[model samples]
Target: MIEMSWPQVSARRLERAGLGAGRPATGTGLATVEGPAEGPVEGPVEGPVEDIVAAMCGAHAQVMSAAEASIGLRADGVTRAHVRAALWGEGRSLVKTHGPRGTVHLLPARDLPMWVSAMSSLPGAHTAAPKSIRMTAEQTDQVVAAIREVLAPAAMTIDELSEAVIAATGPWAGDLVMPAFQGWWPRWRMVMHVAAHRGAFVFGPVRGRKVTYTAAPELAPVTDGLGALVRRYLAAYGPATPDQFAQWAGGPVKWAAQAFSAEELEEVVFEGKRAWVLAGDTEVPADPPRGVRLLPYFDAYVVAGRPRELLYPGAAAARALNGGQAGNFPVLLVDGVVGGVWHQRRSGSKIDITVEPLGDLTAAQLRELDEQVDRVGEVMEGRPRLTIGPVTVGGHA
Candidate 1:
């Protein structure tokens, strides 16, 4: 196996994630959308919003605004409006659904077939609900089928769909067994993510103030779909172990091990540990990545990258991460490693950003950080007011 330093890994990941100093290269396997820069806005917009989301695997949409910021940070002139258009406009280029780890994400509609194929089979999270509340595999299948049938003709709100499902599958599927915040939910809710992963339904256009579910659009499933996703994972965040991939995918380590062995990948000694990268992707950057980046909550890089010790090195481990898990707080990246934690509050057209650095930054990095702040503000659609001080806000759910 070849050897690689943490610096090489970070630099390679930065480039793959389109966060490096250089412009994204064409024909690099990522869905390349040629950026036709429109106005005096400086540089190329981050290709089309769909391409940006696809390249990053998917943008976390647990917090939709943060998800928008995550995508906006990558492009030069693109705004949150562009991201929204891709997700909700007539074109509907992006689909908001449960993605890797069963978390809400904005995935490219074009890639839904592949995503559904891979995620549908993963070992899902163990539910905290009591056994009586849980659906058996067969019963889960029943609920999924009910969802499919109810959603086929038209989109429906959760209430309407729940009634349809209960009527179709009997009261057992609708028993109030699962405990939520203050009320018990119907047992069928246990399989919502499962239903989504299997492409039974997807989030539809909002109806007034309520969210709706629509039957997933049909597409030919990709052959060896898991293999394709594995490659995409490594391409965006390579030189990682199967364990990391499993964590990111919210699957089993054994499953990831099986998937990796099936791939034609090359193993490397990454930071004295065995890790794998895509075949023939061993070339590293001559110089490490420079400059600073402010990544929003649940940014793909902070959540998907492996070996937490490296990405959140030293003091960052304590500041940026929430109980060893990344993405709870927005990360301040200095040279591709977590340098601090930041919080942003937008009031009308102005954004108040507070950054608490773990260590003193060099003058050059500070300058870069200033420009980065403006860029983030542009993406967030606010004028930024930078305050280098303590970030007292708690982590996001």
Candidate 2:
């Protein structure tokens, strides 16, 4: 392996790149309320939602509502309607699919070829089946083939699809059950991701309260390799370690090293540890923009960045993370670092926001926070109600 340490880069410059400070780049999700605010931060970037998704690699969509807000904050004149239209409307340009870390994400349809190729190549990608629900290699192949055969002509709900899998593959596939957040899900559902990773399935529009699955639209072949995806990741959230890359990509460290080696990466010190950035990207902005944002649960910005201590320091870290996991509560970003944690609840037409700062806040910072609160309401199409107080972080308030 090649290694050479370059001059140290300031955290501020690294944050500027990670936060998408000047031009359109990265941000967060969610809503909250306490008091009415004057107005919103004017003129958010205006562009196609797909462009924003592509820029961040992908927006975490485990919570569909939060994902919508994440995209709205980045795109100009975007509303819940625009997000829905882009997702399922005629000429749709995006798809909700399983992404890195096996989490749901809103990825640009145009880039599905690249995502499919890179994600499917990850080590242990096909070995998620636990012993209790274990399938022989040949049986796993049968399951994947059955999924393609059943969903090729029409969309199906999980229950309906599970039935089809059992019909095609026999009783063993349907007999398996696995514990999941929503309850005990059929073990067959676990391997369903295999079909998605192979570009054979994607989330279709909601049929009432249940999510449906459909055949993925055919995408033009992409010649880019896994290294290309790694390059984009470094561009948006770089100056990071290979292990961090593996964690973010939900893959093996060996794969990460291979991808990093393929790029002309330059070494730099991030808080005393060796990290890397793309060659020629070492020039830091003299004055990176200073601002605040409310990032939602599982927002891409919170998930992909490394060296969590720097990003969420001191008490802020305690408030924003639990058991080493982030996104339990929406976070408050003051000048690109996590300064506080927040939560929001809506009643009728009014939305209530509660914010808990890690330390003292200036009057000016509080006012700017109100403005951000208003922006959250605007994105959710609801009235803002702001309340400042102590907030308990891990899980819903």
Candidate 3:
């Protein structure tokens, strides 16, 4: 394998490779979308739902609205309705499930086999759980079986599912309490994702304000395992270190090290530290990415990119990050780097956007930012109005 140093891997080149900047390039095992203008947005962009999900490894869906915008920006003529249809339509192609970092994400349904196999291969955590709340392996299995049984015929809300789990496993399963941001939640709620990870259940349609669950159809296991997952990650966001991969996948560093040890990888330096990339991915684009983009909260680029200091840098970091976490604020990306943070509020048919730049923006940059705001409006299907200045994170003012 060839090895190189940090200076050789420019941020501009890395951004081009990772973000699919400029015209979309194929042959990375990702599907690409092609079409014409639909709404106010221009050009034929690459979208095709499966391709977008594959390119990002998975789109974060903890904030559903943000997730929609993430896909809308990448896809040609994709709207919130289209995304909803993809998720809930009769011929569903995407699944909302617990993914990397124990966070919810939208993954291609057909890729579940690889996901299931790779996620299941991680070594079990060595730490012991509290007996009061911890379910034994057999007990966990029983709970999963109970969930599958309850949802096999029809989908049910968490409350109904909790009751069913208690009925199937006895009241003890619901008796344990775990503290959460919303308040104390039943211990049984904790294992819901565990069931999801094991392919027992998946998020179903919302019933009014309540989220429901349903049985997941069986999928054939993928022959390739952790190694394949690592390759996919590298393909999407590479020149990355093992620890970064571990953090993104919510697995142990040792597991990442073992998985990445396979020989196809080419070693390279990133800011004096070591990283690796797929052998074929080493070439950098000659031209740099231009234009501004309004990336929604938890956008894949913001969430998955590493070397935080380099990506965020100085004041941009302070405004965009909340307690060292990246998703608290919607960010403004100027040439693939965080230039500022922004927030938006809607009233009737008009949306007001407020921008907080880390420093002064040139006249041209401001004009580009305005165009980006218009794009945001198109994605939201609303009339967008701009208010350039400091804006709070979390909520719009």
Candidate 4:
């Protein structure tokens, strides 16, 4: 097994994530933001937003606003508008869809078919409902078919789709079974992500305040299967264990282990345990990632990197993480490890950013943190007011 230091692992992760020094600019055919923030600072840009999203596997979009900051701040000169355009533009090179953990994410549209195929075949990840309210296999199949047929002609709002689905699949499919925001959700609604993963439908543009679903393009054959998906995960966030992979994907550990066994991987030892990276992806930096980074809630880097203890050492383990969850709060990265948590509230043209560091930062680190603040403000489209004291906010604020 190859021996690797923890810092070396973090450095390689930073390099893959395009946060390391002298990162390359790889975003082609991407539009720049319209205007700079009031007090923008020039910084290094890695690439366009789409390419950045692709490299990071996908940007978590559970909080869409946070996702904009997560993707935009990765590159210099990128703004919130650029990320939104990539997602909603004519090219639609980037897409909003269900990804790992069945959560909303901004995935590269070009890669969506592969993701869909792989996720559709994943061992677990299906419509989750109580046994009393669960649909049988035949019922589930009927609901999926109804959704595909109903949305074939054009996009449909949730209400429209719901009515059409019940008409086609029978009223049993519409029985209110799951508790939602204000009322109960229909049984067919439980299979929404399942239908999405199976390529039956993809998220369409929002109409006014309602979300729409459209028929997905015909899917190509599943030539690569789960192996290809695993490789992509390894490339973006590898040198990891099957347990970590399962945790990230919200799949079973046994299934992840079997998948790893099928791949040709190289074992590496870090902190006295074994982990794996792709066969040839063993290079590590002589030094770990330097400089400060303020990652938004559910940032890909914060969620995917493993050895949680190392990434969230000391006070960060408590403050940045909520009950062992990695992405409950926006994290402050000091050389690729969690150092603090931050929160921002937009007030018209200006954004009030409060950073709560778990430890004292050097003057140089503090200055770097300021530059990070400026970059964040640009993507969020507001002038930043940095306060290096306590954030005093709740989880995901």
Of the candidates shown, which would achieve the greatest TM-score relative to the real structure? 1
All candidates' lDDT scores? 0.83, 0.70, 0.71, 0.79
The digit string of per-residue lDDT tens for model 3 on 269-326 reads 6666789887666765455555577888888877777777777878877678777777
Which pairs clash (backbone N, Cα, C closer than 3 Å) in model 1? Answer: none
User: What does the lDDT come to for candidate 3?
Assistant: 0.71
Off by over 4 Å in 4: 25-47, 124-129
| Candidate 1: tens digits of C-alpha lDDT, residues 1-397 | 7999999889888876778877353313342221112111111233367777867889999898899998887767778998888888886888999999889999878778878878886875677766756678889889999999999999999999999999999989778887888998899998898999999998998899999999888877765667778877887788888998999999999999999999889999999989998787788889997768889999998999778998999888887788999999999988889999999998999999898889999998889889888988888888999999999998986
User: Of models 1 and 3, which has the larger TM-score?
Assistant: 1
Q: At residue 72, what lDDT does model 1 achieve?
A: 80
The residue-level lDDT of candidate 3 at 112 comes to 71
RMSD of each: 4.7, 7.4, 5.5, 6.2
Q: What is the lDDT of residue 185 in candidate 1?
A: 85
Candidates 2 and 4 compared by TM-score, better number: 4
- At residue 83, candidate 2 shows an lDDT of 81
RMSD (Cα, Å) of model 2: 7.4
Clashing pairs in 3: 33-47
Candidate 4 accuracy as TM-score: 0.91
Residue-pair clashes per candidate: 0, 14, 1, 1
Alpha carbon deviation, residue 46, candidate 1 (Å): 12
The total of clashing pairs for model 3 equals 1
| lDDT by residue for model 2 (56-82), tens | 678888888788877776643566677
For each candidate, give its TM-score against the true structure: 0.92, 0.86, 0.87, 0.91
